[model samples]
Target: MDEKEVPSLAEIHIAASHLRSMSLPITPILTSSILNTLTGRNIYLKCENFQRTGSFKSRGALNAVLNAMKIDPNLKGFVTHSSGNHGQALSYAASIVKRPCVVVVPRGTPKNKTDAIEHYGAELVICEPTPASRTSTCLQISQERDFLIIPPFDHPDVIAGQGTIAVELLEQVPDLDAILVPVSGGGLISGIALYAKRINPNIRIFACTPEGKMLEECLNKQERLWPEPPQFLNTKCEACRLQQCGSLTFPIMCSLVEKQVFTVSDKTMIDATRFAFERLKLVVELAAGLSLGAIISQSDRLDSNIRNIALILCGGNIDLNEKLPWQQ
Candidate 1:
C-alpha cells in the first residue's frame, strides 16, 4: 500500500471478514442508564475493552500481520514499539500466526502491561521513555533481525483494520448522531471517521484526548509539530501519550474528523474511569475514560442535535495493584 493511501470501505469490510474468520468475537455495544441520565442523551458505549488482548488494537495488529505474511511468505518475524496495549495486541496477533514477535516498550510502562505483552508471547525490549528512543530501538531490532516492522497506528492495513469498528458500530447503532473517540496517534479515530462519514455523511466525529496541546495545537496550526515537549509526555492517560499523530493518520483526521478535538483534564478522566468501574461495571483505562470525560465535563459544548452518541471505549488494560486515581 502506498504511504498516502487511505483505507476504503471495501478494505474495512475485508478486514471485518478476516477478523470474523479468525474467530474474534464481535465486541458489544452497551448503554449505561447513569451515563444517559447525566448526558441527557442516548449514549452507546462501543466496548472494545472486552476484545481480545483487552483492546481494539487487536484488530489492526492482526490485519497488518496477516497482510504482511501474505505479501512475504518467508517473513522472519514482526517488531514494533508501543506503550502497552498495542504491544500486547501485536504479541497476541503474532502468536496466532505462530510467528516470533518483539515489542519495545518505554522504561516506565506499567509492570502489568509489560507482563501482559510477554504473556502474549513477545520478546519485550525496554527503551527510554520517549518516542524517539522507542522508534530507534524498534528500527534497530528490525534491521538486525530482518523482522517486518508493523507500526502501531500508521499503515493503511492497520487503519483499515481499525475501521472495522465503525462497520460493527453502525450496524449496531444505525442512527448514531455522533461518535466520541480517544485520539492518540489518530489511527482509531481516523479509521472510524473514514468509514462512519462515508456511511452517514451527516454523522459527527469528535476526538477526545488528554488535556494537552499536541493534537489540538497541530490541528489549529494546520501542521505537524515535532518533538512534543517533555511535560506533555507525563500524562496519566498512557494510551493517549503519543507525542504526535501518525504521518498517515493526521491527514485523514484533518479531513474527516471534527475541527475542535475535545480536551479532557486528567482529573476528569480519572473520575470517568472510576465511574466506569463502580457504576457501569466496566474496567476502562484512563485513555478510554477521556471520551467518557468529554461527555461528563464538556457536554455543553456538544451540538444540541447530537442526541444519540457513541463513545469508543478503546482499552481496558490497567494495573489493578495501582491505587485509584482518587486515592492518589
Candidate 2:
C-alpha cells in the first residue's frame, strides 16, 4: 500500500471495532507503587503482555488473518519472518481460524521461540535473518504454497489493529498525557501514536529501543546506522533488531513521536526484568525492559504534570530463567 493510503483515524477505529467485535480482550491495568516509584509518575501499564498468545502481536496477527479470510475465503494461510513473538502470534491465530501458517525465521533464532511457534502448529522455515534472505525465502515459499504475507510491522491492517491498544488505553485512562513503547520495526509505537495523538494532540509518544540495536541513535540522527550488508543488524534482542523502521511506520512516527530513547545495556534490561518479576510480579522480557529503562533513565525530561503515563507492555515471550550476559 502507498504511504498515502495509510490508515486514518476513521479506518483505525473500524479496525479496532473489528477486534472488539471478535471478543478479544485488550487488557489495560493501572500501575502499582513499583512503577510509580520507578517512573515518578502515575504510570498505567497496558498489559498486552497478558494478551491472547501472551503478546500484543496477537491483536495485529488475528486481525490480519481474519481480514485476509474476508478478502479470500479460501485464503490458504499466512507467512511472516519473526524470531519469536510475531511468529507465535500468527501461528496461534491461524490455529484458532483453522488456517495453515508458515513462519520464516533466522537460523540463529532461539529454540524455545521456534518451539513455541510449532506448538501452535505453524510450519517453521529457518533462514538467514537479513532483509534479502528473509524476503527471498518467504517469496519462494509463497510461490510454492499460497500463503499471504503477514509482515511483522509494515502493513496497514497490522498497524490499524495495533492502534486498538491506544483506543483501549484512551478509554481506560482518559487523561493520559504520555505513552512509552518499545520500538523494533516501529509498528506498535506508530499505531499507538497515530491513534492516541489523533484523539489528544497533547499526548506525547516516546520510542524505546535497545542500545545495542542503536535504533534510537538512527532515529535521533535522522539517518540509518546499520545500512550496509543488512546482516550487521543486531539480532540479540531476537524480536526487534531490524536495521530500519518499517516503510509504513517511520513516516508516521516522524511527526507523531516526541522522543526516542536508547537503553544502556543488556544488564539494565536484566535488572528491569528482575524488578518487574519481583515487584510488578509480571514476566517481562528484556525487550520490554528497554522501555522501562528508558523511562527510568530519562526521568528528567518527563513533564511534572504528566500524571497518567501509559506504557505499552508489549510482550512476555522469553526464557527468563536462562542466564543473561549480565549473570556471567
Least accurate 10 contiguous residues by lDDT in model 2: 229-238
- Model 1 C-alpha lDDT per residue in residues 1-328, reported as the tens digit of each score: 2334998888889999998989888999999888998998999999999999999999999999988888887899999998688899999999988999999998987788788999989999999987689889999999999999999898998999899999999999978999999998889998898899999989999988876546777776668875734334568887887668888998888778877778888889999999999999999889989999999888889889999999999999877897877789
Most accurate candidate by lDDT? 1
- For all predicted structures, in order, the TM-scores are 0.95, 0.91
- For candidate 2, lDDT tens digit of each residue in 1-328? 2446577888788878888877789686857886788777887878887888778898888878878888899888888877778889899888978989999998887788888899999999989856788889988888889888898888888888898899899999878888988888888888898899889999988887766666666666665665655533343565566556876887777767864564546566667766767778888777777776666667667778877888777888767557743465
Clashes of 1: 0
The deviation in Å at residue 297 for candidate 2 is 2.4
lDDT of 2: 0.79
The candidate scoring highest on TM-score is 1
Q: Local error of candidate 2 at 84, Å?
A: 1.0
Q: lDDT of each model, Cα atoms only?
A: 0.88, 0.79
The whole-model C-alpha lDDT of candidate 1 against the native structure comes to: 0.88
